[model samples]
Target: MVPASSEATPRKRTTYTDEFKRTTVARLHSGEQSATDLAIELGIRRNMLYKWSDKIEKQAPDKELRAPGRPATDELSEIEKLRRELAKTQEELAILKKFDAYLTRLKK
Candidate 1:
């Protein structure tokens, strides 16, 4: 059995404000410094900074919507709706072609 003194203590979790996250992400996007170096300077984890950057990009209004992390349920439903509409349109087009071929046969 291990001694009680040998057990490691857990580190506390830190929360950053939205403004801090936005400015940090913007600085990273500017390419003035590497993420590793910036994270060290800011005293935050590199992976955390990357997550903030991704979140900021996803929130931009003019940017194309991307699937960040798992897609939301609403987005999944919209994609399903589009798929159904495309399938129905393709079926209708095929029927119209067959009808046109039948009409041509009658004319000949």
Candidate 2:
């Protein structure tokens, strides 16, 4: 009888890119095919595909609002106004603290 070890072929490790993983996860989410079927067709394990799908879902929120251009003029103005207000508030607080310290020194 032939040895069982000799009859078995070695399996190679494969690496997939982010684009491929995203595409595969998208297909899996479409509900067209079972994960087992897709994994088998793609020559990868079902568990690996599941992991990829989970990762994609977890990162979906972060990927949703990717603005590819400059901020709006109104947003820029609002930010600048808030920054100026914060600086003015900080300066006023500093002045008040200095006055309080001077008053305390006078009382001493």
Candidate 3:
């Protein structure tokens, strides 16, 4: 049995301000540094930067979502959305290439 005195204390959660988030997202979009480099500089996880960027980009031009409290219509995360898009694009490209090959064969 572990003694109560030996239990580890919980770590504090870190929070960033909206201004800081905007600046970070801007820097990310500027192409001056990679996400890894920026994250390392700011002492945050690389994926955290992506999360911030996604949320910021989806906000209204006035800097707020239409319904802040409502759940997202699409449940997928930003990364998953991009992943699905990439997969669909690749599938279309492959089909086109195959169709082109068939057309070339018929022309022969």
Candidate 4:
């Protein structure tokens, strides 16, 4: 029979909040220590800290709604309204052209 696995099983993944990220990065930027020291103190990976810092620097201040399972808001109503207005303008141009043709025929 095969021996039981010698390697340790993988650990479950964990998540951190935005607040935690901001606080940890702030501590790193305070100039009192390096990322390696901070990572050890915080029980997290140094690379994770670096990734968070990069994200914070490139982030913009905006609130965007994200939904993975639903369709986005519909713009079809506004598009249909503009299309109707365009058709009305085309009809008016056609009437004006017919009147011009009638006037020219009368003058011939």
Candidate 5:
């Protein structure tokens, strides 16, 4: 068997407690410092700060953490997820077709 390479192993995601996340998000919202600066100081990605804030906004007090795209449910059913994707793809296709028609008119 080939030896496992350290580089090939994925790093585990760092998990933060709700209280820590809550305080960090609150500090960000307080406007004492810019989000980029705060992220640098805290050694976290700026986008993660925004994500935590969004989650907090959607959560009821003392509620379990609710993931994005999952509200009041363990997870969205696969069919529902697929339906959403199909709808989005249909909208994109419609727009592209309209754009193509517009360009064809321009070429005439």
Candidate 6:
């Protein structure tokens, strides 16, 4: 008869909390130290640090404490307003280009 041995499975990766992510991003943006060095000190990968930085920049918020679930109705309205502004700006740009073309033709 042979003795049976149990095998250990790989452990799941642990995710950093929102507060930790915010603190790390702040340290990186402080301009007082190198990101790679800070990453090593914090025992996190440089790639992860960069990913977190990108997320923070795109989100443009220090924290996402907006309660659980979908965004608030007001937040959706703000997003729609920004979209409308962008469309208006694009239209104005197109009109300016047409006016410039007309002026160039007149000059010629």
User: What are the per-model numbers of colliding residue pairs?
Assistant: 0, 0, 0, 0, 0, 0
Prediction 2 global C-alpha lDDT: 0.78
lDDT of 1 at 72: 52
Candidate 5 least-lDDT 10 residues: 66-75
The whole-model C-alpha lDDT of candidate 4 against the native structure comes to: 0.74
Put down candidate 4 lDDT per residue, 47-103, tens digits, no spaces. Answer: 998888767754623212211232223444677778999999999999999999999
The RMSD of every model to the true structure, in order and in angstroms, is 5.3, 10.1, 9.9, 11.4, 12.7, 8.8
> What are the models' TM-scores?
0.54, 0.47, 0.51, 0.50, 0.49, 0.48
lDDT of 1 by residue, 1-108 (tens): 889999989988998899898888878766798999999999998999889877876676543333234355566799999999999999999999999999999999
How accurate locally is residue 53 in candidate 1, as Cα lDDT from 0 to 100? 75
Off by over 4 Å in 4: 60-108
- State each model's CA lDDT, in order: 0.81, 0.78, 0.81, 0.74, 0.78, 0.77
Quote the positional error of residue 88 for candidate 5 in Å: 31
User: Which model is ahead, 3 or 4, in terms of lDDT?
Assistant: 3
Which lDDT tens digits does candidate 2 get at residues 1-108? 998878978777788899999888878767798889999999888999878866765556553322224344466799999999999999999999999999999999
Candidate 3: stretches off by over 4 Å = 1-6, 60-108
Quote model 6's TM-score. Answer: 0.48
lDDT of 5 at 29: 70
Which has the better TM-score: candidate 1, or candidate 5?
1
17 Cα displacement, candidate 5 (Å):
0.4
Ranking by TM-score: 1, 3, 4, 5, 6, 2
Q: What pairs collide in candidate 2?
A: none
